[model samples]
Target chain A: MRRPMPVLAAGQVHEVHGEGDDRAAGLAFALGLGTANRQGAVLVVRGALRQGLGLYGEGLARLGIDPARLLLVEARDAAALLRAGLEGARCPGLALVLLESEGPLKGYDLTASRRFVLAAERTQTPLVLLRHAARPQPSAAHTRWQVASAPSLPLEAPPGAQVRPPGLPMIAVEALRWRGGPAGQTWHLQWDEQHGGFRDTTGSLGGTPNRNENARTAPSGAVLPMAALRTG
Target chain B: MAVERDAARHGLAPGMTLADARARCPDLATLPHDPAADAALLTHLAKAMHALTPSVTPDPPDGLLLDISGCAHFFGSEAKMVAKATEITGLSTIHALAGNPAAARALARHGTPAQRRAEDVAALPVSALDLGEAATTALRRAGLKRLGDLVTRPAPTLAARFGEGLVLRLRQVMGDVAAPLAPQPVQAPIRAEARFAEPIARTDDVLEVAEDLLRQVAAQMEQRRLGGRHFALTLHRSDGARRRLLVETGQPTRDPPLVVRLLRERIDSLADPIDPGFGFDAITLSVKRADPLDARQTGLDQSEETQDSLQALIDRLGVRLGQDAVLRLAPADRHMPEAAQVSLPAAELNSSVSFHLPAMPRPLLLFDPPQGIEVIAGVPDGPPLRLRWRGAVHEVIHAEGPERIAPEWWRQRGGHMGEGATRTTRDYYRIEDARGRRLWVFRRGLYDGMENAPSWYVHGLFP
Candidate 1:
């Protein structure tokens, strides 16, 4: 049995990217769920206050995650955004920090990335670098994911019209690089809006909604079923 | 070239050569004149006098003008205040009081008694007018050795002969015209001082002294129901050199320990460390800016303390790494994406200014100068079809806008007609390249000859 774990373990630097607000919201929700004790805040380094609020507030709420634990800090440039992330990591009280910056940031060189990794390790905090429109580059991050909006399974349509409100957001995520685990993994994770968490739909092309409703154990902590192992 | 009163009695006048004065009086003692050193000492003394009154201006060369209008009563009376000043200044100061600044200044230098009469100022020598040597010589050569003689002359003739300077000086000294005294930057009313019995040189000792002074200031601020937003620490060294350190907080605070820690960080990070040359004879801490500090009730969860600790961290970092080094990006009330947010010093950010995230979908990264690119478009006002940026050509697969934004006419009025001001209307577009990389592009200016031909620029990137 196998399970897809969304946990960003301590000291690991995770890189995630996608279109619009899902990247930040998905990561915050995943990281928030993994940590049993929510004593520290989840920092988001991004501008556009309303955008962050909408994504985190609505997105987290849909996943049944509390949005109050998220804190947004705006930075002037990519380098500043990285510095803010590193500073946040130095605080042992912080659970995770997400640096949402433009990809191919000019000043974020190898040395700067290494410093972030080392600082995260020292403070026992996980860091996620979310880049936009950026090409893959060598970094100290432990995992890298390329995410996109997936066509969610349509909800039961009313009679002949077949019209329905948009389904819960589903992200098609590809693991481009994984340091410790299997690389080149893919998954279509549907957000369980009412549960405030994510559900793995790797069993079938159109997995029945809430297939993992009864299996509540953390995937990394428990054994996974055979269907989830198809793509890894 | 100024001579002591005794030297003047001995016929050694100002403008007299040093050799001539020494020749006239075989036992005459002379020391080199240091104008810079004198000004510094005068400023230090004036700061010390701030303990007596807030309005103390250094009347350079060797005097301070104290405006004790309503403050004199603090020491019981004007006479007692003067007595207190003499005591504080170590009996070296000569005090005088008059109705006007010019009169008071002239009387103080001339050792004239406290009298507001115009005739009393006139009785003093013309040198008391503080006119330069050329004008003083011109007045003396005209047989007007006393201010009284100069004032008695016909006003028009005096103006014509000695120029307007002498006439103005006569009117000022006689209290006949208004003369504004530019006071030293007024010191804050809340301050604490400590004069050491023995000068201390070690860094630890200096910090201890600063901490003690901070405690006193913090207590005073507490009594007034205020917190200090800015603090200034002035250290008067044993050799008379003074060093001042200033630190500003993100929010008003009355916590002495936090204030001391911030000051220590500032001192430790100075490019040139605070050298308590020989030692520091006196140290003063002043609350340069104070704000009303209402008591905050913290919930049992201690959420407020978390905010305070975060602010304290920012303050400490700001002091150590220079205020400009630590910055926070805040929303600006401008439509231009680059101008939509501003970077402010972390220390200057207050809790009062709420930063609302802009509602519009702005790009993740904005080009600071908005780099221009060569573009091929169907129509002048349409989205870019293919653009050459940074020497590479990007084919536009899908495009989304002609979001028109006009130049602010009110800003153009009375503003320098520079490149930014002369900008015409802009049409922005959110375009996706062939590789699915999203870019925010714009066409600057219009084809209607409002500015140069419409040019293309890649303004930002969408993540």
Candidate 2:
């Protein structure tokens, strides 16, 4: 049986978590949601440290997000990040606010999360809290998602080529908690740069029987059975 | 060796030797001269004179020149303006008004009351020309002691006897030619100030005064069709201490409430809060920079309102955080990854250049200095098979071609063939690891048999 794709509602707080090496994927997913909404400008607030490198404008444009409409605020610490996030959430002109921080964000407790939710709801602006290298905790978020990188589909190569290049970016997104809807659903989505949104590729990967063995060993593929049990 | 009135009565005067002045007046008291202190006093007096007119020029040493031709009516007459200036400076001054700067300067310094009141330049002494002692003595010895004797003579004859400088000085003092005066550059009078009978220490009362002053300034700006981009509020304490608050906006604005809001944010974010020590006795608001802004209609359209709110948000963030903390990304026209884009403060960025999307895919995040990695390639010049980065080994699952990028020779010193040259060619590759983490790695230098082996670096990460 086919199931409909779940969508995050606006005017609420959502959380996205990416462990250790998968932090970039979490940031990319958050940016995808921001660009797909296409309201006003997007404000991205992050701490100074643990950002490995900085955001590249050309790379942002390649992801179909306009660099001109992006405002980057680098805070000195998590507290400053939360303050900037609260300010951004209060702005009604912003379509989305992305708050990124590493480690356990002590300042983002229940009170802070509820404050962000109240501000977002008042302005009808969506807020996405991106946590890197941190475990999920209880909060007033509308939904919580765990993201990990997935192998992209191979690009077309010449005849008898020894190796094929990676194609567009792909990621595995699993819903850990849903406030009003059924949770525990996993989706493998590939970024479509031309259309500037995600395309469901869960069925296409199943059709490639020759690559099934490799997929079974992948971390993204291992989460399917657990998700199935929770949904059932 | 200048003296006060009592010493002058004792027959002492300036330009006399100290020993001679002491001999002339046995009880004379003198202190060393400080030119710096004199200059500071002159500067202070000049600033004080700005209230009377905008064209007050300091004559240095001990004088000021005021151009009161059109500004005298503001004080009812020139005498009243001079009286007000004296009151403001609290100094007994000798002032005069004439047709030109040189005439006024000479009249204030040398002319007697009768000569000044009659406005008779020709009746004054020849010393009024200020052409040095040699010329004055020559004129005096030639029985032409007064300016009237020189005025009656022909110009060529006067120039021939007393030199061209004397003729020019004579003409300048007689108002025959205009003299140049360097007046201080004055800003527009978009200022409002208030003084309280009793000092107010409460922050609320201070803000109330600020609001009142802002309303007055806004009205002045509206009348001129101007908007301020920078506003400064200065509070004067009863004990002579001053506290100043400055607020800036992204666009020219005349809204008093918006300015007050920004000022409140600035106060809240201050590292050292305003103490209001001994309370504030006076408050003044001034616009430092203004731009031509016409009256704007509000609630025009949804897009306009959205833009307005966005600008307001940027301004607020800039005030709370530092101006540099809030930034916007602008594309730079360069091929190097580090120079491809620049982050600039949102308030200062007015870039109109369109961003050119790179033909090849770029990573989402780029390291400023690419991190080095240990790689074991399949061949000496081929793609990597496995790489060790940050103390971890990653097996390459998929590999792309080696897109070679040559160094920009024009930007390098020695044109790529000297000991001082630092840059080299790089071959970039898009490689995906076993865990599906794609990275942009480049091999620095070539594997040719000329130098040492080439090294690899991870330049960026892909999402």
Candidate 3:
């Protein structure tokens, strides 16, 4: 059964935590939510991390976010990241602000999160905080989500074909906390590039496991998938 | 060693050995010569001479040439202009007025002040030609000791005897031929200044004067249907120290209040606050760069207002954080992943470049140089069955093919088939592990059985 994807309200602060090596999933989820409306430019303030890679424009375009409408600010430290996030959230011209950080940020305490909430409320701008390799902490966020990568369904091929490629990018998101709604609801969603939104892909064969089921315990690892025959 | 008037009176001259000069005057004081410092001082003096004329060329070592053809009327006469130039430089100057640059340079350096007339160029010595030592000595030996003697000689004979260089120099010095003068390029001044009789020390007072000057400049820009992108406010202190404060905008703007706010932001962001050490006697505001910005009516929709607000926010943040801190992503037409996008400063992004989406799925986060990983593939050219990365092992559940991407051979150091090529072909795959963690990994080289074994690397993470 398909479940309705949780909607993140505007004019509030929301947190997304990456589980294990799923930092990219968290970032992609936040970007999907931020660029959902396609209203105005999205401001992304990123703090320094151990990883040396940066955001790629081709990937952003493929994800349905216009590269031209993306404003990026690389903060040298945590304090700068908070400052840029607060300032961006206060601006009425931006549609959304995404603050990405790694590990435990020093200055992003409850007080700083409250300031961001206030600023975002004043401007009616949605603020999405994407945290990688960080634990859940006390904050003023209206909702918090724990996100991790999920295996996608393979594309259908002819009877004689030897291989089937992966379909779309999929993720398993669990609602850790909701301000006024029921919490702890898990959903397996896949990015639909044609519609520019996430589609619920739970309970399908050869896809992700059922909701709340640890993906490591799934029984789909025994079958050996055929090698793809196409070459670039 | 250059001697002063008193030392020259005691028979000491420039270019003399220090021992000989000290023997000539035992009490003589000497200082080491610095050509770089001399050039810097000359440049400073040339900048001060801008008040006399817009066209001022610094003649190297120790000379300045000013093209005062039409600028003489600014000071009522050429003599007063020369006096003003002398006063501004605060140095002894030998000024000359002539028709051409070469004649003027020769007359100023070699001729006497009484011979400043155009016809008196002939009376100058043969050294005025400046044709180097050998040419000058040959000219003197040929009985042409003066410029008058060279001018009377036939041109063909002179060219045949002393080479074409001497004849060209003779014509240039005699003003028969014109030589192009490379003057320092100066921008048209769009500035306003206020001079106070009594120096003011208060910060508020200085800002008030600055506001007044900004208003004047804004009005001038409005008249020309233009807007300023960069503004510089210079404060001249009574003790002769000058302080400059600069502010730039993301878009052209002439609104005084907006500019004043930016100026205030610039002042506050300064590492060391502006100090009115001895008070400021004058303040000048100049528009360093101006662009044509036509007036537009506000639309009923909020789009225009939103763009204006966005620009204002960019300028504000750029002033506080730094210009480079605020950036916009622009697409680059390159095949390589890292070179596919460029981050440019927000203020300088005039046009939006759209990105063309690739046919293949690209990972959201791409490692700059793909990190190496240990892979256990089923075959040399087949997909990986298991891989270990960052001290973690993962069993591959679903794997995709080798999407081969060759290196850009045209961008190689040598020819396309060069022997010392470092970059190898890569075959990428999108793989999902047992835990459903998707990764984009690549094999470094092919298994053609002619070279070493190929290695695998994890390039990016899929969401």
* DockQ of all models, two decimals each: 0.06, 0.46, 0.51
Q: Provide backbone clash counts, one per model.
A: 7, 0, 0
Candidate 1 lDDT at B351 equals: 39
Report the C-alpha lDDT of model 3 over B305-414, residue by residue, as the tens digit. 88888888788778877899889988877766667778899989978889887898888888888899999988777778899998899888777767887776678777
Q: lDDT: which is higher, 1 or 2? A: 2
lDDT of candidate 2 over B1-120, digit per residue (tens): 456878878988889998899798878789998999989999988888888888989997899998887898999987888789889988667777788999888888888987777667
DockQ-superior candidate, 2 or 3: 3
> Candidate 3 at B384: error in angstroms?
1.7
State in Å the error of residue A119, model 3: 2.3
Classified by CAPRI criteria, candidate 2 counts as acceptable
Error of 1 at B32 (Å): 53
Query: Which segments of candidate 1 are over 4 A away from where they belong?
Result: A1-87, A90-232, B1-189, B193-205, B276-282, B294-297, B351-360, B379-381, B413-423, B448-452
> Who wins the TM-score comparison?
2
Over A26-138, each residue of candidate 1 has an lDDT whose tens digit, in order, gives 35334433343445556666632222122323223333333444555666556556656776776665666777765466666678778888988987778877776667788
i-RMSD values for every candidate model: 8.5, 2.0, 1.8
lDDT of 3 by residue, A110-201 (tens): 89999999999998888999998898999999999988887777677435434556668888888889987757766667787667767655
Q: Considering only N, C-alpha and C atoms within 3 Å, which residue pairs clash in candidate 1?
A: A1-A224, A2-A224, A49-B357, A50-B357, A63-A196, A63-A197, A64-A196
- List pairs with backbone clashes in candidate 2: none
Chain B vs. true chain B: TM-score per candidate? 0.56, 0.63, 0.61
Model 2 chain B poorest ten-residue lDDT run: B414-423
